[model samples]
Target: MDATTLNSQAERFLAELHRSPQTVRAYRADLRHLTDWLRETGHGLEREALEAYFTVHPHWASATRSRKQTTLERFCRWALQHHLLDRDPTLHLEHPRLPPPHPRGLRREDIERIFAVIPPEQTRDALLFRLVFETGLRIGEALGVHVEDLDLTRGDEHLTVLGKGSRKRTVLLDDPRLVSALRRYLRTLGYTHGPLFQATKNGRGGPLRYQSVQERWQGYAGRADMACTLHQLRHSHATELVNGGVSLATIRKRLGHQHIQTTLRYAEVSDSTADAELRRWRRQRH
Candidate 1:
C-alpha cells in the first residue's frame, strides 16, 4: 500500500471516528506514529509490520500498549470495511494485560505544596485545579462544567456536571474557600454563558481542550517540583472524604461514580487517618 494512500484512509477513519474530539486526536496521533515508523522501515501496513511495531516498543506499559492497540484495531477494521486492506491485521493481535487499579492520593501537605507554587496572579488555573481537588471531579467533568450549571445561591451552592456515561450529578460546593474563589473567578469572567473554563488562545471563550488542560496541569506540577497529576487531585478528594468518615454512598454520589465499586477503589485510608480513628474510638470507650 502506498504511504499517501494509507494516510488518506487513516484521515478518513479518524474523521468518521465521531467520538470525542480528544478521542479522535488520540487515534490520529497513534496512526501518525505508525505511519512514521512504516516510512522509516519501508514496510506496508500488514500483520507482520504491526507485530514488529509492538515488538520494538517493549518499554510501553500495558495500559499504553492497550490504548495504542485499540487505536490500530479501529483503524484497520475501518480500512478493511472500505476495501483498502485485504484483511484486519489487528483481529488476531493479542491484547495487553492491564494492571490492577491502584488509586493514588496525595497527602494534604503535598497538595498544599502544589497549590502554594501557583502564582497569585493565575487565579483561573488555581481555581480550576482546586475545584477538581475539593469536589472529586474527573478532569473532563470539571472541564465540561458550563457557567449556567452553577447554582451559587446563598444557602446552597452546587454545580451540575456531566460525568462518565453521560450521567449528570450535582456536586456540592461546601468548602468556603473554594466557593469564595469560584465567586471571584466568576466576577473576573463577566461571561454569563459558555464553558466555565475557557481557552485563552481563542479569546472567544471556547471550552478548553483536554490536552491543553493536562499540559497546563503538568507545568504547574513541574513548577511545584512535585509529580502530582490532574486525576490524582480527584483521588485526593475522595480519599480525604473517606478518611474523614464520609459514607461510601455519599462519596459515590459526589464523585458521580456510576457504581459503588468504583468509589471503593479509592477508599483506602492512610495510616495516620486509621490511627486517628482508633484514638477516637478509645476516647469514646471511656
Candidate 2:
C-alpha cells in the first residue's frame, strides 16, 4: 500500500490498541519513522523490506530497536486482521537482552547521614523519607497516606498503608524515634484531620502532590551528596527487615505484595543467615 494509506491504517490500529496515551504517542512516532523510511526507499510493506530497513538503520540502539519492533509487530497484527497485509513482518524480530541486575540499597550509616543533613525547618520532608525507608512503602503509597490511616494511639505501633491496586495492609514502625518524628511533624503542621502530609505555603496547609515530594527528595539527595533515589529507601527497608530475621511471609503481608515472588526480590538475606536459621530449625526438631 502507499505511504498515505499505511499511515491512515496505522492511526486506526493505534486507536484500537487501547494503550495509554503516552504509549500510543510513542508507538505512532516509531511507525511514522518506519513509514518515512519505506517511502524514501520505495519499498513495499513486505517482511524482507522491513528487515532490511532495520538492518540498515545503525543509529537505533538495541532497546530502541526492540521497542520499535514491538510497535510494528502490534501494527502488523492489526494489519493482518484487517487484510491490509498478507503476513506479519515482525514475527521473528529479536528483542535486545536486558543487562544484569544490580541491587541498589543504602547502608544504615548512609541513611543516618542523609537524615542528619535535613534542616529542622524541613522536618516534614525528612520524616517522609524516614517513613518510606522504615515502612518499605512505594512513594505513591506514602504520599497517599491519610491522617486517619495512622493510629498513633494504638499500642501495636503500626500504620495502615493503602498500597498498590488499592490494597490495605498494616506496616509496622517499630522504631520509637520514627514514631516520635512523625508525631512531631504532624504537630508542627497542626494537621489533625484528612491527609497527614499536606502542601504548605510558608507553613499554611494544602494538599501535597507526589511530584513535589519527588523533587524535594532529589534536592535533598543532591545536597547530601548521596547517590540514591527515593525508591532505594524502600529497598533499604526491605534489606533491613530481611537481615533482622523477619519471615518472608510477614514481609510480604507488611509490604502489601500480591505475590510472594514480588516480596522475595526484596529479601537480601545473606547465605550465612539462611544457613543459621536452617540449623536452628534442625536442632529444634532433633
- By lDDT, the best candidate is 1
Predictions in order: lDDT: 0.89, 0.83
What stretches of model 2 exceed 4 Å from their correct place? 1-103, 271-286
TM-score of each: 0.64, 0.63
Candidate 2 global TM-score: 0.63
Error of 2 at 197 (Å): 0.7
| Cα lDDT tens digits for candidate 2, 95-177 | 67755454667888987788888898877787888888888888888888888788787467778888888778888778788
Report the number of backbone clashes for model 1.
Answer: 0
User: Which regions in candidate 1 have their CA more than 4 angstroms from the true location?
Assistant: 1-96, 276-286
